[model samples]
Target chain A: MTVKQLTLPELTEACVRLGVPGVGLWREPVRAYGTEAAAKLVHDAGLAVTTLCRGGFLTAIDPAARADALDDNRAAIDEAVTLGTDTLVLVSGGLPPGSRDLHGARERIADALAVLAPYAGERGVRLAIEPLHPMYASDRCVVSTLDQALDLAERFPVEQVGVVVDTYHLWWDDRAPAAIVRAGDRIHSFQLADWTTPLPAGVLNGRGLIGDGVIDLRAWRERVDAAGYQGPIEVELFNDTLWVRDGVELLTDVAERYVRHAL
Target chain B: MTVKQLTLPELTEACVRLGVPGVGLWREPVRAYGTEAAAKLVHDAGLAVTTLCRGGFLTAIDPAARADALDDNRAAIDEAVTLGTDTLVLVSGGLPPGSRDLHGARERIADALAVLAPYAGERGVRLAIEPLHPMYASDRCVVSTLDQALDLAERFPVEQVGVVVDTYHLWWDDRAPAAIVRAGDRIHSFQLADWTTPLPAGVLNGRGLIGDGVIDLRAWRERVDAAGYQGPIEVELFNDTLWVRDGVELLTDVAERYVRHAL
Candidate 1:
């Protein structure tokens, strides 16, 4: 697989060649290859679809747009179902445009979840609310802690809604271990990545490849395992450096490091 | 105050002339004026010393440097006592150099506080641990929420330790009001400022002058007041724009807005 550009076919081949058991697929990449074609490529390669990267962007200044988000999330659930991925990650969106009302945004998230959970349950997909880092509070996700994600999980049936515990977003959280224990079976996904030193131009580029930066991934694995979640732990790195490398090289490094440092 | 080429004496005189009641004096300015001379000037003017801007930088890679931090904090406490400021604001430093052990650094902070608390109490000064925003978690302060500050405060005597609830750091917290209520008498100081759009330089230049940004100051004042804190809510703006303006003009505008929108 080449680093300069990655097609669904190349990504699937890379995953198989690098021996990564599973991969977290972003929506744009899936859309690029067409969902059916992407699903067939991964399935043909015998690669597990750990999760679909996102579903929720519920914050909207207009009620119509808010309703539209729920409809869109239902479509995402269908996509997850088609991909044979049970977990659909949701990033509860930030405050409405020009609005500083964080509380109101939270309420909107709750409302969106209430609408989306039923459809996800019917589709046999578990909706995982991923608590982003607090840095994203202004323009990304309002859910910024595992405790907050657990709180949201409590509002829905256990089989329908859960939480994605990402090390990159939560490694600094003092309450992470306790929150993981509290999540128990509701912890649907355990995602890993490292926090880089210098934040890139977009802040998103600052995510480090697993084992590249400082994160207690072994401890996290023990915690999640102890909490009764035996699901595939996805390594989702968004590093510009890694992204520019040959896909085979990147995947091989990640797989080796994941086994040595994370698994 | 004149924006250009001002000596410490000139800066101090400008603060007094601006009718700001008290300034949140930093160590650099204190060092520039000589701590004793600065104290004498405040004493001579009969101006109240509201709070010292900082004390804690307890995280260091070298054990000797960490000990040095404790010693320096002791000196800061003595300076606060000499200045007649009841509250010494502590900005808990971030992860020690070359270490990703956040939990270990937190333990060191607790240990330092335990050693410093009794000495601070003896000097008739309270240590106010200010929890900065989470964005500064890596390089600035580990304490990043009001709830975390309250958790730390629970370890010390109410008279010796408390929290500085700054709106700039906490406006995004969903549990801020409840945490404020929980802090109650442990709330040593209430600081005001506004959150502006386009955070400048992504750090120091981002703070907005009161009423110029999006914080609901009146609601915050009501909540803090309801929590039974009768202390004067101080206006602490760290804006580059405000720093460039005439100190008299800045203070007048702040005072008028504080009364009109906050009180």
Candidate 2:
């Protein structure tokens, strides 16, 4: 959500002006702006819809909740199709409320993927499992490492499921480079969000502007390139500090940061 | 630092009164109380000094800084010996100032351990590598997983170096259970702190007291038990909310929670 302050049309317009070829759209804003209209806007502007933000909070113990999640995921897959983005990022949900069974919770994610992966595959949309940082393992997503994401995704066909290599989430992991190699063509989407210290309260919106943090963004880009991931390198930041600024200005900054640090 | 409000003597007294056999000591407070005096107080009170809180921060890029870290670690080992504790927990430091090389930082920790481990071992103490949570990997410790800690500790003799499986830091890792098994006798210390949501600002003092959040403490205890760890199960919380309460009352609450959730 780097330029979350911009409207869909404004985002597409900025991308075109900034020469940012592809735009990754979050589901909420897309739905709010009319998905078909958003698809048309980006399409008409000659920009690729790189990915649909999310769809997987499937770690529910309640059967009804599980059904709801599956339905939501199916809807997300449909949205991806409409947006013409083959990649649907799945943030596998955290442990169900008051449940200490992380294993069971992960298994539930696998179960949901079993139902959704093929549905996604049939529609030419791949489920991209984005393993968030372990700090987010409680309420955000239990998938906390590249290896864990690979373990889950490897069970499905390469065409059906894959992983997102986000620098912010996986930079602390020493083995992530090796895991990236293993991910190979299964690296569906590569995202960039640098890690900044003293994470903001709620720990949700502290993502750094690329070069502002310690991550070797270029090094990660090289590794992902070596892994045969010929995908769009999307800058997906959730930063409060940047959000308050003008959206177009932030987008310009992001484009400059990406070229300077991530290129 | 669950019962940090309690003085050394007060902590020892509470342990005795509550039939708690052992207490872990942090370096600063013990140094403040006089290391020898603190040792005598705990020993005279019939309590075991389970461990010394820490001795790390070896990821300095400057040679003089690295040398200082080593000298400080040497003193920590000395303090652990004086306290009659065989374990000195190490919170291996994070990135050196502007450095983006996590591998280099981790190598620095290894370099520090090479010097300190044997020194501690000679004095009947083991350097326990406590992998802080990945959230702390930026400023606190680069060793963010038990597997990473084991990777470092295994380079030294088990008597000289080992890993600390702190629930708060490790419970999020899907592979931690298997890593615990792999650790076997290299597991030096076991600590408890639960995972709570909407982490507080700064993110350093939000660790939950046992049973207050999402960790399966009893299961972790059982896993470590199965892995042949016979050490004291230390309840270490760095919660700001709990620190304001009465020390004795907090100790009682911790003891109750430990028995209920961690036993």
Find the candidate with the highest lDDT and give its number.
2
lDDT of 2 by residue, B185-247 (tens): 999999989999889988998999889899988999999999999889888889889999999
Compose the digit string of candidate 2's lDDT tens values, residues A95-139.
Answer: 888898888888999999999999999999999999999889989
The worst-scoring run of ten residues by lDDT in candidate 2 chain A lies at: A94-103
TM-score of 1: 0.91
- Give the top-scoring candidate (DockQ): 2
DockQ list for all candidates: 0.37, 0.87
Off by over 4 Å in 1: A1-5, B1-18, B43-46, B196-205, B211-214, B237-261
Error of 2 at A209 (Å): 0.5
lDDT of 1: 0.81
Number of the top candidate by TM-score? 2
- Alpha-carbon deviation at B262 in model 1, angstroms: 2.8
lDDT of 2 at A153: 98
Residue A202 lDDT (model 2): 93
lDDT of each: 0.81, 0.92
